[model samples]
Target: MTTSLAPDPAPDPGLDPAPDPALARELRRERAHHDACRAALARMAEDVAEQVVTGEDVAASGADAEVLGRHLRSRAKEFGEQPPGPLFFGRLDREDGQSHHIGRRRIAEHPAEPPLVVDWRAPVSRAYYQAGAHDPQGVVRRRRFGWAPYSAGDTADLTGLEDEHLVSGEDVVSAIVAGEIERPRVGPMRDIAATIQPEQDDLVRSGPGTSVCVQGAPGTGKTAVGLHRAAYLLYTHPQRVRRSGLLVLGPNRTFLSYISEVLPALGETGIRQSTLDEEIARHEVRAVDGEAAARVKHDVRMAEVLRRALYARVALPDGELALADGPLRLRLPAEVLAGIVAAVREEAPPYATGRERVRARVVRALQLRAERRAGPLGGAWARRVERARPVSAFVDACWPRTTPEEVLAAVLADPDDPLLTAGERAAIRWAKPPRSFRSARWSAADLVLLDEVAGLIERPESYGHVVVDEAQDLSPMQCRAISRRADFGALTVLGDLAQGTTPWAARDWREQLAHLGKPEAEIVPLTTGYRVPAAIVDLANRLLPELGLGADVPAGVSLRRDGEVRLCRVADVATGVVEAVKGALAREGSVGVIAADEHVGPLTSALEAGGLLRAGGDGGAGGAEATGGTADVVAPESAGERLSVLPARMAKGLEYDHVVVAEPAAIVAAEPRGLHRLYVVLTRAVSRLDVVHGEPLPDYLAS
Candidate 1:
């Protein structure tokens, strides 16, 4: 279907067109309804606030009132969470003349009554998004509301509305939806519940029991889709979700902070938002991993090696011993004990469980022999035998229990482990092996290994649902870590394979899903680019095939036609970047200046030298309010800031209205997957991309 994406028409000063009275009346009516719902929600929160937990709420067996009180308080907070912006975005009229407004959340006068505004994820509200001229789905007409990008918590921000009359076969080229999608991202990311496409709706409404992976292209809204899916699950399955819990994982802390507001805006509060690095931080990462060492440490093979090393610690007895009572002599055969050890190993329980199993079997074996010899002794006899010094000593000596740190340290420090190659061993082994694992400095990859070993000892805590963004760059070992936490639940995986910049990034979604322990999860592709302009997407599309993602790596089509792309060849790249920033700042969107990790300082210096204020970290620089300066170079995590200068790596899950990339060749030369890194930062632009470089552009883009 063709779409008209012309920018908002500018009103003329010379001529005043006749005002449409119908539109004005309808908008006023809608605004009044929005105000009423806000009032109703406030009442709801007030009512919940007055609630008191009593004996009826808990059992007489003495349940904790404090726990119940917290639950009630949290529920009240959910009702009280009224984020700024449009509450309800669309209206759907069924064939039977019933009208329903769809919004980010449900709003009703009372708990037992039908909602005044249906939730966007409700089954009935699906028609508002999926209905078209051909398939109305019982919807006679659908109305879309247009509002200001950022509102001041007032209904005055409601500007215009559009309608689609399905029965009359009226197709809508919605200027509001296009404008919202094209709106510049300023501070933290916002919810897209109002503008979710049909394809995205399908993924968001997927069953809570199923694991699904989305191989979305840049600007495909995959990150937002994952967050929405999580909110959907929390809404649909409150008990099943909160029973174990829900987790949302991003690539880094900045990305997590970027998306921290999306779920809360959807009326979901207190949901755990974290990065993968922060999740498995068993110890402080005081050391960095060399390339070869990281490979060995994050290798899937290391999991098996850890298991073997842990189990090998169990010692088998050569001969049985005699259990001497005060006046009795008891003897057991060595083969009988050997049988128990063999059986437990074959059972393949967790390391801790296996040790207990062997001990229990050994004690039981001795008890049976004693009972048979003594001819039906009391049960206390078995207890006595269990606590007997001989039995305890034998079990402790053969079937030993150990910690993850102890086992891993021994495996790495072992100079003669046949499972590891000489080079592999040397690379991963600690140079100055500490006297204890507690005092040792662990690298990031080492923490992943430690997680694997910990899982072997006992299962990690499980979540009902897990959402991981930037998943294509997950190493096999890292995937195993996520798989452990979500073993009993399901995962909603989101990423773009072409944007994967890690050395161990999976080329195939199938491989990545397999490592995630969800091989059967459906691989869904979202190739439609909405946030990115077509020109920028086209530029990134040229570099896809070179990343070895296979022939089927589909090219994305940007729905935006008005996106701007420019190439600036300059003698000084820094100077060019400063100029681009100035131009981007002249407009009303966020500006991002991304360069190789090593070049961030030089670029920031250039911006500062060019009279731009540096809005940086807590101690280094500040935001507009902090610095009280205009044209600031901001940090990505600084809320309400308009400009961010970040390294290429931090650009993975972020977007901006205008992006100035310093050098393509330098980005490519930064790492082995440098080409993919270049592809990521290039596509981060929502409206325009300015390539400022002293060196020649990448071959694919140049051609």
Candidate 2:
């Protein structure tokens, strides 16, 4: 029962062309199906709302009933409204003559009736994304529907359809995929549900317990794959994921805002998203450390140094312990008291826990000795001896309670402490010491140190899974911090080694994975560039040799080869950037002007002066105002004609339709890993890339 639409042709000048009856009939049938699905969804929403618990029931059942009622009300609110996107995008046809419409959510008229739309995460919808001519997987044909914008008070409209015959020996690339990829991006990043390639689908369907490390080049769709995997895991293992929770960690707030809408578009709303610094440091940090200091703090060896310094506080008692209260009198010699303290230290408990245990042990020993010499001491008398000033003083002197902050301050205060070797002291000691502990400034890397010490004192709670984006920039100690959070679970690590811009960036995936506590995790390399044009990617690939990617660097594949990479030399860099941005804005989609860290302020000012950048209180300046580090200036509106002035390092996971890069040589000279940072900035263009430079280009690029 396949319905095919006939192709319509233009009429000749002198003759009247007859309408294609089959085309009209097919359009009517599809329209009817769309209306029916909408009606069914409306009815489902009504049913959920009517089932809300009443106030009388809540009153009778007390607090538990009230909590349950509130949860139901929240769920009802979510179900009552529908978003603007199409409900169903694809349909799968099986060899057994069965058909199912694939959509973001499931919709059924009744319990006994077949579902009108099958959720994309359902097992039956796998063929829609994975089936091909070589391996049909029992699929006959897969159809993708094109949607028209919905009008006010109107249901969604299905305008057209494209089909790929799985058994016809044709290519997997369909017209639907080409249109979806080429569509103009007006707002935040959207889900690539309709255009997910076969290779990406494989990673998305990986099992729950499997930890995957994706070594993806620019435009390879790694971020999309990670988000899709989160949604897939939620569907496959709902109970396990819901109980322990799932988290997505990004590089910065600006990057987070760029991808904030992706999960909700994929029908997932409960997943928590945060930056690594935000997760590790819950409080506000006002001060920052320089690059040299941050590098030293982020080093993994600092963990060992911290451990030695913390445990150095525990020592043997130097004085005798004498406690006397009425009938209970106890006197222990210095040697015997030292032995007791040494025995407790041998157990290697936390400093605070060890102090409490020592006090209890001294009290018990005194009661035992008193009973042996005189009559048996009562429980009340033993309690009085435990509270005696002498017993408390002995325990405090032997095992002092310490906080993570206090211990970190003590380590940094003295440059020549024995716990730190001469070389280690030189590396970690502050160049200009703080006046006091209260004035000690903590950097982003220092936050990781605090998390590490907190972990050593007591084990941290573990999550079910963690998705870490831009993981190659994470230091060894930072990796350990993230690993501790998901110790018993799995991780989806995403990054390009060539894109790592930090001083302590990972050199290889094997060593980084070991630090993450998943040494055996599978490493998957995605070299295909589906988003960025080939011309732009080729320009960026020139830095591969410097990045140690070797001669086997994979060139990205682009469907549209019409993109141009322009290199211009100008007298003034700021003027050239403003002109380039104006030209890009005149075209379509968003535009980004990426410059070096020191050049962002001048570049932003120039753009604003030229009236190219909008100014009315957007988040454009928030990234610049952020403490510790520099970030991209994200415009509040990301729609048509929107512009973002970014530092080269902040362009990691973001893409613009057109990009203007200023002074390539200056970007390469900004930091130790500036070449890698420049490579990241060059490949962020989806359609075209314009390189404008006032100074000579880098040696690698010029050659």
Residue-level error in angstroms, candidate 1, position 369: 3.2
lDDT of 1 by residue, 473-546 (tens): 89999999999999899999998888888989888998889999999999999999889888888888898878
Write out the backbone clash pairs for model 1.
none
Among all candidates shown, the one with the greatest TM-score? 1
Please give, for residues 1-703, the per-residue lDDT of candidate 2 as tens digits.
1222323231111111232566446557766776788888889887777768453255545777776777677557657444557778788889999999888888899857999989888889888888888888988888876554222213324445666788886554555556567554445677888778888999999998999999888888999999999989988998798679899999988778777777777666767999888888834686677666677778887888788777787778777778776655678888877777788778977566677888888888787788888878788876787788898777767877676777787777664556555766776677776877567787676778888877767668788889999999999999999998888889999998888888999888889999999999999988887788788877777778778766333545565555778898899999999888778867756677888888888887887787666444342221122222222323343332357776787777777778889998888888888888898899888887889999987776765
lDDT agreement of model 1 with the native: 0.80
Q: Could you tell me the lDDT of residue 638 within candidate 2?
A: 38
Q: Candidate 1: deviation at residue 41, Å?
A: 0.9
Per-candidate TM-score against the hidden true structure = 0.92, 0.85
